[model samples]
Target chain A: MTPARRRTRSSAALRVLFAFAALIALTSVTAVVTHVVNTSAGLIAIRGGTESAATGDAAQVLASWTLLESMVYRSVIERDAVERFPDGTRIEFRSWLNPAFITGGYSADPTRTGVRGALIGSLWLIVIATIAAVPAGVGAAIYLQEFSAPHRLHRAMRESVHLLAGVPSVVFGLIGLVIFARLLGPLTSGAIFGVRATRVPTGRTIVSAGLTVALMTLPRIVIAAEQAIGAVAPRLRLAAFSVGATRWQVVRDHVLPQAGPEICAGAIFALTRAVGDAAAVIIVGASTVVLTDPSTPFAAFTALPVIAYQWAMRPDPSYRGLASAALLVLLLVVVVLNVAAGVVRLRARRTR
Target chain B: MTQDVGVANERVDTLSTEELTVTYDDIPVVSDVTVGFARGEVTALIGPAGSGKTSVLRALNRLHDLTPIARVHGSVRLHGKDIYDADVDAFEIRRRVGMVFETPTPFPMSIYDNVAWGARMHGRPSELDAVVEHGLRRAGLWDEVKDKLRQSALRLSAGQQQRLCIARTIAIDPDVILMDEVTAPLDPISTGKVEDLILTLRPDYAIVLATHNVQQAGRLSDRVAFFLVDESRAGRLVEWADTDSVFFAPRDARTEAYISGRAGSDMSARGRTG
Candidate 1:
């Protein structure tokens, strides 16, 4: 074949192949969307316990009720219950703050009050875990990356840390249950802190749960921190050392600041993961619900996912709505975290 | 800024090696080579690939210590003082003799920071801004990069980056400057600019450049060293002479074949006698 004609034929064939590939990609996207829609419809039907489409007024009322529920009905219902739900109902409502153990009021009623208790519990766990984990994890990573060299023991330790990161959350829960709840929790509660601490009778309290979740997430944060620290160009370190900066000075002034955003980003992601982790909390026995907030660190607590699970599994059909609402709240929190991360990334880029 | 040619006439020899041999990973590289570099003059080291031009250049500033496995035998004297003497601190040695490497490995930093790094490393001139500006001016980059001092060194074109590397090295005000294929990566015009920088800087510093470009060596160097690979594949200094004499009347057949593009033409000849 003439070189020119051969090139033309090949180019034409390539164009056809690219078109075919484009068609496949479009069809695949359509198929995925269709599958998702169908699955969601099926899930909605299962949740609703109805195959037939709702009749005219029923469909309209349900749709409008959803809107009202979001915008106004929830507030009105909450106000009415506060005014007239009875002292016993109020006390049960307050037990959510205590967890079922030392319950003052909050209960698993799937009410707005109960869901609020769950939200507070989850947020407390996430925030507390983040506070405890960030320093510990990032400190360990800094020590490993900047202070230590590759020795057999250190390498083994680093590998073990990575291994810890891969352990199942449920397994961490079990460990937390055995160690913190069964051992340290009781010791700390009975001897030192006092009656308030002992309110977590089995030692499986908010503090224990938070600590457990921190342990479960610690390895992930450390590993990511290590990676971020390691990602700093060696030239920077060399430059610092050549300028007579002390080793610690290099880390404190240059390395850590440069690694701050990445480490914090990883820690935030880990904390978000900790927020949604129900399995570990479940193992740590986070079932108690007190309507009042924990006055102390050792206080028992329940998390949103556990509460959502309890409400969602209930035989009552109305409780399903509460589960959906809780799910929506969780999604919102995750979205907020992702958006904050995006903003931070943009700022970092602009600074560089 | 041409040096007083009388500088060469005054000292005759500013730096010299006695029976220098080097090895890496137990493999012999350069062996039994004796040469001298003249004062305030450009001395070019040219040789075939793996003829140990770089290893020899690195030894001059004791930079070979940076490589854990590199071994050296022989005494290299600067102003009659053996540079490798135990009392000589490597940092002090490096401060006195600076190097610019191939590929323009500028610090991942602002252009101003890159220029000031060496000075900072050597604990010189507390006024960093002034030092940076002075270094850039000397490098002939200040006019183009004056407005972009805060910009990343990497933002500059390759030629500018190479000059930035030179500025960084000279910022510390070293007595000797080593250029290892500094212009090999530049276009002819950029190469000429660098060659001009070399010429202008000669009055203030002694230069030892290792280049594969024979014509470049002829054009810029006052003295030339020709290295030859012997049967043992170890580099040997065959001849070191005045630049014109070396290029026009090279004493060694290997040097003649090399300059004429005949000896080991397919392989990179890296040795230049300095």
Candidate 2:
């Protein structure tokens, strides 16, 4: 074929391919827009106390929101309690968006779901996990990056840490179960702190969940801290050394300052992962349905992810909305943590 | 060959090395390098790349301790005491014998803090502000950076950062200062500023400078040491003498060739004869 004719033929074929891709994109955009425009966040077939598609007399309390029966109507739903908007998104807020729901507990009815217990349990998990992981992870990173020579043993240790980051979170939960819950039950169950419990408190407490999160977060923090440490300019270390600073002194004053923001950013991301993790919390003894908030660290506990996990798996279709709402709350927390990570990263860039 | 450099025995030296040899992983890179730097004088170390000038500078302050595979033999003495003795600490020696690197390294901190950091590392000085001012003044950086002491040192230009490094070294109050091609990364104006700083510092401290610039060596040095690589590719000290003698009346044929541009090019041949 001549050059012009060959070019024209290829251009025609490219035009057809572009048109096909454009058509697919347009269709997807339309479908998404239609769903978003037609559906409401509060329109999930939910009733406060009535099983509505309203044509049938099949009303069940479990299909409605978590509110008192007096506050709800046959179909008007949480009419004057929790909150009622002009647009009829009444019971939606009572069960999933109100202060009561956020600060309350769970029941078998699914309509009475609240996440205060899980929220507090998650806070405990994160606090203990930070205590367990940050120091250990940062210290290990410093030693590996600054002190440890690239010999066989240190190399093996480094590689093992990287491999640990790849291990499933559920495995960390098992480790927590075997070690904290069974072997060190007294310590983990807070009996060592002289707190009295009804049954001496089983190993499945906030302590076990926190330690499990710690274990899973440790490898992530180490990996991130190592990368941050490695990115530090070698020139800075040399400057510190030439000024008569010792090895540890260099790491503390210069290296650590330079790498701090990046390390903190990494730690936050790792914490986010641990906070969103469910399987590990479950395996470590956090029940899917938590009814009470533990007053002390040694009491039985549950996390948001665990609650979401349990509710989403219910045989009844109405429980699915509650599960999704729980998940959205969990997602909000994750988003907040991710925003924290981004802030740290921006600060790091500015300092450098 | 080193014994023939008869001019080296003249001064009351502040720092001296005897039969010094350095090796990396058991392979000798620089061998039998014996030289001295007298107080109130600048000793310029001129040589080609990979001839071990930097290695020697690193050895002077025990900087080689940072590398496991690098080894040093023979004795380096300061004020008549061998610094390599086991009883002596590397930190103590480094504090006494400071170094300025080829590239400027300004810490990500305030200008005042950069100058004061070294002083604080040893022990917090009671009068840190006065000490910082003195060090910066001595480095010729006090006036330029006086108003911005609270700003980050990293914001300074390349030359200002280098002077800040000098100020940092001075803050520790060292007896000797090593400069490793410090002006190689500077513009002409900055080079002039640093060279002037070196001249002012000459009367108070023993300075050893490694440089590829011949004219700079002639202008800034009182003494010169020329290093060469033999067939074995191990660096050896060839000549050491007063700057004028080394530049105007080189005794060694190789030094003459290198100095006169007959050895290769000026950039390639940096040796000056005793």
Candidate 3:
């Protein structure tokens, strides 16, 4: 065959292979989604009574499978109700999008396991963690990248920082448990500041958890900030220097301004990790069933990931639904944060 | 302006180097080069690549301090004071002697802020607007950028950016200005504009320009210093003379051959003579 004909044949074969691969992916995704929905619906049916439970479970399974519920009703399940199969197995299809699911305080009772407190707690955790980590991380990065001499000590310092970033989150959690929870209990619990101390001196409060998360995030932020600061062109610094600006002046006016958006992006990424982290918070003693809003950073708190982890560990179908809903919320928060960071990065690029 | 010109010229030596040697990582690039810049006059350093013209210019304002490996020996005096003295602050020296680079580097800020940054760093000037306007006008960029002062400096074209950099350098009102091939990367038209700016600025500030472009050195400089890399690849001053004499009756054979475009082979031959 001619080269053109051979090329066309090969191209057609490649297209066919791509189409086959796509079909396989689509099939696997559909299968997994169907299995999840059917299993949830089946479990709900066993708990729900015989009459409306079966109808609701059937409708839910169909809705989840077809994705029609989202398009039509903007939800997977419309209301908290029960239905049953002919054999007397029951199912409960709770509306995951209900305000009560998000706003109600946590309880052992699956119906009252609202994520409001956990959501608020996660937000506080991220905010406090970001506040504590960004400056410290960026400062360390600046020192290492700009000010520090290229001597053996600085090289060792850089290597140590990289090593810190590679350390497991559990190690940081252990540190938090020992230091923030045990050693600095009075300070973290605000007992030293003359505030009313109602709880034990375990320091298993929002402040402790936030600090732990901050420690977990610090290494990542420092590495990212170093890269961002390093990415700035040397000529820009020289330009600042030539204008008679001091070292600090050059860094503040030129380096920081140019690297700010990227640093922010890195900080936000670290915050996202802190927000989703469960292992570290768990070790630091964050509760999975917080019933009230944390009034202060010193107050005991639980985060969304902790709550989701708790629900996921349960065998109950309702708990599974709650966990799924919590995971969805976590996903939404991450997406929103990323989009905000993207917008900031674009604005920074435009200005530069 | 007329009175300022007369006052500026009255000070004969604005800045001078005494046995200046610059080493980067223990290797000397500029060795024992002594030169003086007269007030209100343009002094040009002309050389082939790697002859340390730019390095010498940088050393004048303590720009070498920024490079960790760079070690500057000997004294650089500004107004008869050793700038490199232990008690002397490099920051103060840099403020008094501003510099422009081969490439335009405006700060990532508004055009107005880019020009005003130097003044602000010195201690926020009370008359910031006037300073920005004066610097921009002096660099020949005010008419184009004045209406859009709030716009980002990076948005300016390459030539405008270079001029903005010049404006930024001049904003602090330094006693001397160092230009290291400031127009090398620009188009001929932009080079002409910058050359015109240098000529216009000659009456107000002591200017040290480093350029390999022989015609540019001859055109704008009152005096020209020829530097060459010896067999050791260390830059040494070959000749320093008035522009007229340097171009017409060069005392050094190397300088003469360099001006006549026959220096390439002569330079390699002279490298063996070292």
Candidate 4:
């Protein structure tokens, strides 16, 4: 080879070598940073918060502590309280007098203040938002991608959907507050069950928050669903139609199955956004004193973010520390959910 | 078979076309072209790209309805019945006049599903599994894929995929098979296999094929329809005659030049076979 050609080949090889080195460096840095962050956040210490040095149920052993303690806080302390078995080994105990056991206390029941309530509540919001947004958004996307002919009018509508995605979550909250919380709340509440259907003046209830988040997340589902549907080869669609498949059957069989995983991933992302969002709920009017777990859509409740926000703003140092822990819990929940989505997407791609 | 051939040739002698024209958006692509496909015979359509060979085949099958912009100026009749009659359904036309594409366009499904798709779509009775198997056998793919009927059609080699497509078209038991360069995108071995299959299948179905390969036309078809092209002008049918005569004694000099390697031809010269 000529000198110039040899030099060109050498440079190409050098560029590849540099890329490999950069990748290795990045991986090492990421590993080290993750280790540092995990250790500094006191993951193990958070578990220690539930441990107690005192022995026995407060009502059975320390009647004094039980008598003076509020039902909510005392209930939690009693549940975690330790007792020596007859054989002399100590173990944690649960008590019947705990306010969480019978009536809602701090966060519905203080005795049950583990990740259970946060998990169940987060799942509630996520599932609700997914149910509301995924079908509506993905259906719209399929219609646009497969059925709608390209023209100025259709193009404008597509652009409008994209623009709606750019609108802020707070804006969606304002709209939801006006529409779902105020206008539709009483109507739906009265229709479902007979009561003086009440709507909170501040629109931060779970139902309002979920509807708001669904509106905010709808555009993402639509865009992603369109992309997934578009990824199916045009020839397949032609084949279906040529075989006398109705437009509906073509979308149902050839388009939707191909797009299903992507739509699911979009739903998962939207759900994560809804579960982790605090600002919209704050704007709408979330409650601080939720004495019971949310069993009804209209039930006033405290979600993880709202609770974390309240705790973080408090003047007490211990409460701030508690808020930091809650923040950690929230972060973990989002990461786990996103990772699950990633796994599903990867599996679908491999099969395709 | 000889009696059938005698009758088919008599029909060919009497068959005629009247003022057939195809236009897209008021622009005539093929105009005033009159042609007839001989029954129970292989008729090769040889042309350059954009010469409307495949378009004519599609019009024959009433497949032009798939393209919303395409419009035909005259009627296409099969056995003296107008293909575009008001009562005629495109689906019925497709059932009678099947087609295979230039490229192997198998569905992203199992091999059996690929062949069974047409039969199922046409509402064939149950026992389509047997039809699928029989089609595969006819297309000479059954022995190789009998054990892997459930395997994705896309997983097959290029040759197998092409045969799978052929099997798919024939599963509906079409009276005519319109193939648009069905063997162009294949290896020499695979091309030879398909040529053999075509000759074998001619006894069962009338075959109309469009191909860029002059040698393939000479070797496989009975009658060849030559479509000629020139820039700034719509394509036209230059000649239609026996394949052997067309190859050896073409009426048009351009056709002669195309068949022999010595002269200019519209086809890609990268992979020529004498």
Q: What is the TM-score of chain B alone in each candidate?
A: 0.91, 0.92, 0.93, 0.89
Over B1-274, each residue of candidate 4 has an lDDT whose tens digit, in order, gives 1224446326542123456777786776776667776556788988766677877876777656656578887877766678788997766777767788777878877998888877887756687988998999999999999999999998998888988888888787777788889898999999988989898898777788899787888888989988765453556787888888888898888788767755434342221221
Candidate 3 chain B: worst-modelled 10 consecutive residues by lDDT: B1-10
Q: Which regions in candidate 2 have their CA more than 4 angstroms from the true location?
A: A1-42, A46-100, B1-10, B264-274
**Which candidate, 2 or 4, has the higher lDDT?**
2
lDDT of 1 at B55: 79
Fraction of real interface contacts that model 2 preserves:
0.70
For model 2 the local lDDT of residue B163 reads 97
TM-score of each: 0.67, 0.84, 0.85, 0.75
lDDT of model number 3: 0.82
Model 3 lDDT tens row, B8-119: 3354577899899999989998899999987678999998878889889989999888788999999889878899889999888898899999989888789999999888
**Docking model 2 quality class:** medium
Model 1 in CAPRI terms: which quality? incorrect
Order of quality (lDDT): 3, 2, 1, 4
iRMS of each prediction? 4.7, 1.2, 1.0, 3.0
Query: Quick one: ranking by DockQ, best first?
Result: 3, 2, 4, 1
lDDT of all predictions? 0.72, 0.82, 0.82, 0.69
Native contacts conserved, per model: 0.02, 0.70, 0.89, 0.11
The reply for model 1, stretches above 4 Å from the true place, is: A1-108, A114-158, A174-198, A201-215, A221-275, A281-287, A294-299, A310-321, A342-352, B1-39, B48-97, B121-126, B225-245, B269-274
Residues A156-238, model 3: lDDT tens digits: 98898889888888888899999998899989888888767676465888888899999989988999899999999999998
Candidates 1 and 4, the one with greater DockQ: 4
lDDT of 1 by residue, B95-159 (tens): 66778877777766789877776676555566788888888889999999999889988788889
Which should have the higher lDDT, number 1 or number 3? 3
Q: Write the per-residue lDDT of candidate 4 for residues A1-352, one digit (tens) a residue.
A: 9999999999999999999999999999998556434321221111111333233222112212221232335544444343312322333343322334223335322223333344445566676678788889988898888777666888998999999988887787788878877777664333445543254433345676677777878888888888888888776765554444556766877778777887777767767876788777666656665555667666665667877778668774434434554566677778888998898899989987
